[model samples]
Target: MSFYHTPKALSAFDAKFEAQKIAFGPISFQVAHCLLKFEVLATIDQAGEQGLSIAQLAQTNVLNEYALGVLLDMGLSMGLVWLNGDAYVLDKTGYFLLHDDMAAINLNFVQDVCYQGLFQLDKALVAGKPSGLAVFGDWQTIYPALKDLPAEAKASWFAFDHYYSDHAFPQILPLVFAHSPKHLVDIGGNTGKWALSCCEFNPEVEVTLMDFPGQLAVAKDNATKHGFAERIHTFATDLLDESRPFVEGADTYWMSQFLDCFSQEQILSILQRTAQAMTPNSQLFIVETFWDRQPSAASAYCVNATSLYFTAMANGNSRMYHSKDLIKLLHQAGLYVDEDTDNLGLGHTLLRCKRKP
Candidate 1:
């Protein structure tokens, strides 16, 4: 009973734990890398119960069997595989990695983008900007390079970006549509992913997506795929510029996974313009990750890394503003915070505001 009160011992334990984590960091990185590379789990899924040998796996995926063996051995150490007499089989944890089940969320996106992006962490820290942008110069400028990426890689990026709303939106829909907005505008709505989700959930709602010309095409394709082409409209515009065309008579203006890609001045300006375009009864909803007054280690890492990534790649950053700071920003634009819902998923929060109604 008294051992718990030993502060010195506890501090020593924490130090040791941190040291261990630092030492084992590369293990974590490699395990994830190997998993994605081998498509071990995915391969198993495709091949069914028939396990593949290292040679078979290598030939099938066009990989070097010797190099893959090293990685697979590492994975076995991490308990992700079972080495059963020369044949490799997916263990319980490894099985999930292959299938697009619950754990699909983890393997698909974060591992592909965030993991790879971390290589430039030092550069991001030094430059005070996202490593992607720092390395690539601009977000739009990098797409041309990615055009030749394999389909799996592209799908991984899409999965990661869509992780914000994939399955978490339904839980927050009640809180989101409590005010029952009719006409909705999604600014910087990439591919209309969120807009489609909102429209699907709220059948009576009409959504207009405003984004760049390149992205509008993707959004249009998404709308068509969702059979909401008639209900969803697309407009191309630069949201940062003063000459941007605005959405009018909208009961709700939604920015999902948006708004973090700017300076405070830019955010205020955008909000002010949005306020001007809204009716007195209109509402604005911003869904984003929030940093607590004293953020946890995981939250801090995610927010800081994401901020750097966006800044470097897209000229954007993630701001984990507190509730009061959010209110202040809204008020600066003549809008007021009406309500907020926390813990949407991970460290995310939703701030629902209106035109000082």
Candidate 2:
């Protein structure tokens, strides 16, 4: 929070340069992607201290001198490559773009799932609907349509979704199971990853997954494959359907990387129903990547930019939330944060809530 409150970090000249970067962000993004796709960055990286010239890149890689020249010229401006005596060397930014797992996953997700759709962000904002979803198909939201998405897009989406939470699960298991819950209800349990983890963590805990039928089907299959079929059960329903009551009285309920998919009103409605179902002893844990809670400016930037994916591709009304807003919603729903843990798994925050006594 203090980071945001301080005076501007950049000088006026540097600020103007930064603004230009934003203005040309789309072009820079595609140019960077192209460099990766054509192995231009990789070739330069392999050259080490010697570096590679346009003619050398042309001779070595499939691309001609003209193609390498244009891409590498843009890369120079983008700080992805540095020019030294007519030879191009890979820069730190280029190294990360080529080898960083997080960068690769996010790049794929943006390109395959959200890039084309993002063009319609303005319309989605005005219409209060995922107007950009038309690029894929006619769907109210991206959740149910996940099963039908193109192979690359679906892969990227799931990879991006799981990467953050997967690291947190090991750390969270100890906290969640400290009290020894008998029954754990995984709300918005996509593909039963958490439920499966819970089962493996505690041999005796009964895990029930609650999600859309399509997602539950995949989760059920995974459970069966892992031979945890008996321990992990599925409860399929649309959580946003206010008339439908949630499965009640679980000892612990978990919503991981789930709530951000919804608008504020919908989140409140879901939380209210969840509170209705919780007993006095019941605990609810929410795992999310709250932008305000991020540790660094880079992580914060990533979280903030992800909000547009919701606006254009996911649901059109939800964005990555501030922690304060979520805490307020919990209070409204008769729940209060009993414990808040930050810096878990890729800048995620885990909030443990209990019914207000």
Candidate 3:
């Protein structure tokens, strides 16, 4: 069953409450973030089941009593904390915010990279341009500007981007290496993480990274640092520039969490160019978190919400794709899905495509 189907899980009152939550989401999010940032949640969590009163929590040197009280009051309404008599305790959701790696990474990414820019989302939608990205500078997309982003934003952006793809690497390494590819091309090779992974996976495999010069520079640094300098090569070019064709020698081509950085039309153009450069024996692997294929509603929700980040901050037209839509694009590009594997490391679906016969 599709995970996107509507459900009658909430009552009329519950639905209204949910709507109110959405209405107050921005402020509530800021309040909850402040609670975590000031270590208010940590104090309550450290207090164990005993919890802590506003006065006691303030004594921990985290925040003043007034600040603690106001944030806690909002936190209580937001369900991040609970009131047991006069004491405040962290809720399960709060626990995740404090401890879950994914949650923490996502939180940082949202706050550092997306928060301010997203204020211009309405403008972006109307103009079909990243109006929110004006907070950063005059970049057409976030990718090229990645290197120059403010320190916190750069860190959070990489953490968020790498977390999703890095988790799936170990599982996919065997599958991709099984083909015994002599040369592999890593498209949209951000920071050379996947290229490094391939180098480590196969001692003899030589990998080429295709991306903008700035990104390639970072990737090259990472490659040298990891001692894979000789094996991991760089090809600097703009994929959106249709005049530049794909570098044509690799037996294996890989794009992990990459294609979704483009609109359907752009994706088609990219796939077509790649297809044109491929030999009959070439194999291309596409890894993406297709929202419809998520393992749970929560995962699906996160993926869907991330689509807006693309619209408002990253690029103005791209989004997380449905597997069917991507597959149709692949077919239109003269490629056929030879293997469709899902549920690989954090809901990524790996589509192994080959040139149509």
Index of the highest-lDDT prediction: 2
lDDT of 1 by residue, 1-357 (tens): 112234544577889977886788767556755666667656754554556678878877756887778777876766667776677777776665655443565455445445565667676657655565333234443344344445665676566667666655777677777889788899888778778887888888888998777888988988898899888998788887987769887888988777766667788888989999999888888887755522365555556555554544444344555456666788989988777777776556788888875
Which has the higher TM-score value, candidate number 1 or candidate number 2?
2
Runs off by more than 4 Å, candidate 1: 1-14, 35-111, 114-117, 126-150, 293-305, 311-316, 319-324, 345-347
In candidate 1, how many Å is residue 4 off?
19
**Cα lDDT of model 2 overall?**
0.91
Q: What is the C-alpha lDDT of each candidate?
A: 0.69, 0.91, 0.89
User: Compared with the true structure, what per-residue lDDT tens digits does model 2 show for residues 137-249?
Assistant: 99999887888999989999989888888888999899888879899899999899998898899999999888888889999999999999999999989888888778799
The sequence of per-residue lDDT tens digits that candidate 3 reaches over residues 98-205 is 889998888889999999999999999998888889899999988778879999999999899888888898998898888798999988887898888888888999
Clashes of 2: 0
Ten-residue stretch with the least lDDT total in model 3: 1-10
